[model samples]
Target: MGGLEEWKVLGGEGDQAFPCLEKLSIQWCGKLKSIQVLFPALKELTLSGMGGLEEWIVAGGEGDQVFPCLEKLSIERCGKLKSILICGLSSLVEFGIEKCDELRYLSGEFHGFTSLQLLRIQDCEKLESIPSVQHCTTLVELNIRSCRELITIHGDFRELRSSLKKLVIGNCRLGALPSGLQCCTSLEELWIVSWGELIHINDLQELSSLRRLSINGCDKLISIDWLGLRQLRYLVKLTIMWCRSLSYFPEEDCMGSLTQLRELDIGGFSKELEAFPAGLVNSFQHPNLSGSLESLWIYGWDKLKSIPHQLQHLTALKGGGATIASDLESIGNEIAKKCGGLPLLAKVLGGTLHGKQAQEWHLILNSRLWDTEDGNKALRVLRLSFDYLSSPTLKKCFAYCSIFPKDFRIEREELIQLWMAE
Candidate 1:
């Protein structure tokens, strides 16, 4: 029900509305001010685009339960919502709030939710702090992003050390990472992005179970403790990009220990970076990393004159190669000439041409798509790659990814299911 600006209350005193309703969604009702109903069996509730809603009041005596079995609650774009007086939601497994620009505080009793597992808060411009979830022992995923005014996340990390697996915090104003973050020994995936005040990141050696780590767009980051990174023996993926001030690259000795690393992406250095780090080039030749690597992406090194010859030795790369056959060398050089040394375009073309037949390389070299301006070459290359995909389902899956927000991480099983649904 949308555009219901005259509604002030959903239920009166002593009223029991939808006693057996298991799911409810109220969207875009701008002036529907309050929800006073008792939904005893509600398992999911969504209030979205409620522009005039200021409060959600639980109507009952002090000890009476309103929604005893509610498992998921989502509130989005409720611009004026300020308070939610709710309790007895001990079974809530997921809670998400987004784009509530005027919300500064949550009046709900979140501490008693013992089964809570996922919590996400985003785009709440006025929210300064999150309520403490220290008592939620089962919480596994916490994601907070784009809350410009958010200052602190109130929680006791010691209590979440064992259960929390994934944590993403970005686009906020915190001067430093949350205290006690290193204590989450079970953390598997961590992303730190767009933070401006953080200068040094240390203490990551404590997260022994980490599998993927990404640090991007941190304009002020200067150095990372590579010695600590060497301790992550199980790390599979690592990405460091757009951190212009970061000058230190891990030594070859430090990279030797990452035996399980499958993907490495490091680029976007400052103009002051006169040359690519010698240590990184040598690290690529290390038997441990070279044999295990499957994907490699390196760009933004404008000063580098040539691609590393050591990259040719990474035999484990999936359908990727740097050297062409003797017959196709001239065609390969022609393709390179067309790319004009743009690092990003070169990387894309390399992926597309590698492991393809000789005729396919000629097709790409002779295509009219190359007649476009230099700036549009990347798009043409992407279009060519998309056309080459043999599986229609794979094409649909690739296109479906654009529906999500940038930097959003979706699990493999979930993404496959979404593709199937589509």
Candidate 2:
């Protein structure tokens, strides 16, 4: 609709009436200023790239229950849009707005949607505030990202702590969490990010149901209470990244109580971090780490090597032509478990047992090599040297080469030709 300045109506009298229409998408109608159509049965509505649109009000006036059955509403790239009202949309379940920079406010009581479960508002730079979800008891996921001007997340959450499973707030300037977030005991996954005024997450202790916690890019954040964190027995994955002011991590005694903890990551360009946990806690030990801790561990931005740099591609060893690709993979899995992310150990182990049977490799993997000090020393001493060639044919080749003068250097190509001729 390049020249079309308005969209007045849709569907016709008979078969074109769209009586069963469940979804409608309006896009690239730049001249369109208003959506003067309504679909009572529409379950989803998407409007995008309509540069002139200022407001979308369903055909009936303000008091009518317009879109009473709408389930999802998505608005994108309509920068001039100022308002959207879903006042009585009782069946609306999900609402999303993206790249609508001119959106000043969402004009509706979010509490009106009894079934609203997800609200995602992203990249709306001029948007100032959102209606509270304190009264919406079914809200499960709330994500607000890059709304730099957004300052308040209304405090009505405590009155009804619904089963909110995920909450993500990023790149905003809110100084603190909404007042009653501490009472959200059913929250499971939480992510707080960006250069916000929120200095600490000490208020989130009430999230007893939390399993994953990620805090990143908070430039002002300084400390975390690990003693409080140690009590979260169900916490599994913790990621703290790019928080330039954080200077402390959990003490060893607190670390010991995290038996259910699995993954821990910490990295940022902070000058205060000299030696991790060393100055943070009096003394720290790896033995204090929980047994169920399966995946990564990190501390300080400068001390740790990147994953891609340290864990080499297994195919690199195929260049040595010692083991074929398929066989090397089985060997790789076993070696990774024993070496604990040491590339040298994996490479040496792979080359050392190149031609060995699968059973032999498994036997070596099950050994106490990683536990005993002498065993670790033995591994450091071991190498995939040429003398260990188990094949008698290769051994004879080495012995026969001694027939030549001691200082004479033999070319491998000539040796292959001689062996083929024999």
Candidate 3:
């Protein structure tokens, strides 16, 4: 049963043909054309990488049967499979399909699935659309990603919205957002990414219960309508990244109204900007806004020169006798400490002697020495550490680690095995 790679073994042909198997996996069996596996107690089944498999049918005692006790099923990377005909699976809850390019249809009828809860489809490039679920009332979560040919989603999504709390779609050519998604009052998180032609953000106005929202890599996006987001009073985190055409942040008092907003990350905006807005940093320090605001990351601003002076109040290091000017210097000093020593500050101090020494240690400990000009300086520090290891046994043990690939984690067991083999 373990290593019989190529032998046609029928289910009822043998006297005792694995009737107690609750889980079965058939992998890399190149000549397997058909499977009539009938395990009455089977709850989970997985078929993967079997190249010659063209069809599969599960039969009942004598006629068409239903897997009344099956809970999970997975089909992956089988190129010849064209469709999965569900005869009867009354207890199935979760189903997953991946990388099967030739699969064009999921099943003959969608109403057969009465208890399915989660359906995930990924990387099946030839799949055009999902089968409509007319009878699946208990379904909750649906995730579709990287199916390039899938352009449309049909059927009433609102029917599942009452129980479906999470929905994610990414890397598909979907051109418009589905309507009536706002009725899902129980939805907490929503995410959309890499839909090339998506230009509208107005469809997000209906999500009143959404606490977290993220949109990234949608190149054609132009603006965000803050008026539509007024109902999202409980929103905590908002992130918008890699939107090339986004020129402006919401007007000063726009995001200030979200009293519950805690974190904001607006990075990779490909436009040139001179500086942040005047009252922008001050808003983070406002009494109502200050209590919830914790982290802010703004990157990819090519023309950004410095942080605003008011940002000093937002740092945790500000305390008694520490004026704004002094606190600013303290923050800069902390960053310099983390960098070992500031190259800019070292140049102003007349030379980089101390800076060079600090940089060398930083490179050696972090193991980033050989990847840049600073690596040569890091190598000098690493050699110094090696010089102290004069013991032959310790030196040989450390030298053996060099055989591993760069950035590899050298486990204690692997080192012991290498030594034993030697």
Candidate 4:
């Protein structure tokens, strides 16, 4: 805390004597720090929304390991935190850190986490590297995202080739896939997005056991080579999106090779891409592979906004229900026209006139406010929103008074003063 002012930290050393304390969460405790917490029996710990914490200084004990029973740790949105130490947390299995904007580094001896299975790091804008996890043989899943300043993944993961199954990397500066990944024959799922620095990934063909692959929004990537993806007979799903520079897909022969492929999603390629190769669609629809291709999503049409189709809305008024009066139907038609094919607008406006008296319905139909255009289109749809009111000023004040109880009396001066204050 630096003794700058008052601070609030949870759990004094006296709590260490409690053997049954299995879970502890310090949230929105702006001043909480390592020096103020000593929970020896805690099995899971979460720190969130801590605004003043600068670093997590590892705790020490007389001679034994601290946090000997701790297995799960999650830290999020501690905006001022810079670093943390997990060197002695040998029993930790799951670790997740996110949204600590000032964090620049993680300093710890990470090799001791023999039990660590899942690790996720996200939105730590200044985190520069992931400390070497080459020793985490039991690690199974890893996810890293939105760490734009994180240019390097320090782990080689040579020993984890057979253990790791899922990997995701997105919106980071990580330059290239590590050579160790070439030996990850057991890896099944992979997702990469918005990685601007990556230029080549031809080494991926080594993953003969791979099943799902997704690559998206990587502006720098230009091609997926045949040798890079052809041998994976087990591949079932593939998606490539927003890689504008890519002009080609694996050839028809290469696609025909994937007997198990079920879904294909490719989108956002630029106009330079050549027309579909001679037999690409034919091969996909071949009698031999008819049932294999279950879903195909191609979004190369850049000018297309959405699927063009008529939208229909079902409502009591739109159904020409028995509740309507003959005179107000014209006004309802006008409102529907103003809605301009949007179903939600028609419903809200239609519901406004439902169950109204004939006089009030006539007043709404004759209101002059709807004739004038508002400054904003989206806002215009709701303009003169309480169309039952007569004037612009009354439109603003009627909503406030609409909540009053039936026949409630109010002095004229107080009502005027309230409107002025508003």
lDDT per residue as tens, model 1, 1-422:
55565533344542355667998878777877756566778898888888888876655643127768889999998998876664556889998999888888766446678888999988888877776666778989999888777777776677889998998988876767677778888999998888767788888888899999998888888888788887888899998877888887765655667899998877766657776677777777889887998877765544445566877767788755432233454677788888887877777778877766678889989999889887787788888888877899778888988778764444578787887785
Each prediction's RMSD over C-alphas, in Å, is: 7.9, 19.5, 10.9, 14.8
lDDT (CA) per prediction:
0.77, 0.68, 0.63, 0.69
Judging by TM-score against the true structure, name the best candidate.
1
Error of 4 at 142 (Å): 0.2
How do all models score by TM-score? 0.74, 0.66, 0.66, 0.67
Tell me the tens digit of each residue's lDDT in model 3 across 1-422.
Answer: 32344443454542146557776666666567655445566788777876676665554342114354678888888888777765557777888888887876665545666788888888888777776654566777777887777777766666666676667777777766655566666667777788766776775566767888788887877666656665677788887777776665554544656678777765555456566544456565666555666666554445556656655555432132111121222333443443445354333222222213334334433544334454454454455455545587777787888899763445678898887787
lDDT of 2 by residue, 1-422 (tens): 76678765455533235567898878778888765565667898888888888886665554224565789988999979887764656687888999998887887666566788898999999888887777778889999999998888765677547568888999888877777877888888888889478676776557778899888888888776666666666888887777877766654454555556666555563655554444223212333342454554343355433322221222222223112122334555766776766666766777777656566677667655566564463454252334456787977786668666753445577777777777
> Residue 341, candidate 4: how far off, in angstroms?
24
Model 3 stretches astray by more than 4 angstroms = 1-19, 54-64, 80-88, 101-109, 133-135, 248-252, 270-286, 302-422
What's the TM for model 4?
Answer: 0.67
lDDT of 4 by residue, 137-222 (tens): 88888899999987888768778888888889999887687559878888898888888787666777788888998888877776
Which scores higher on TM-score, 3 or 4?
A: 4
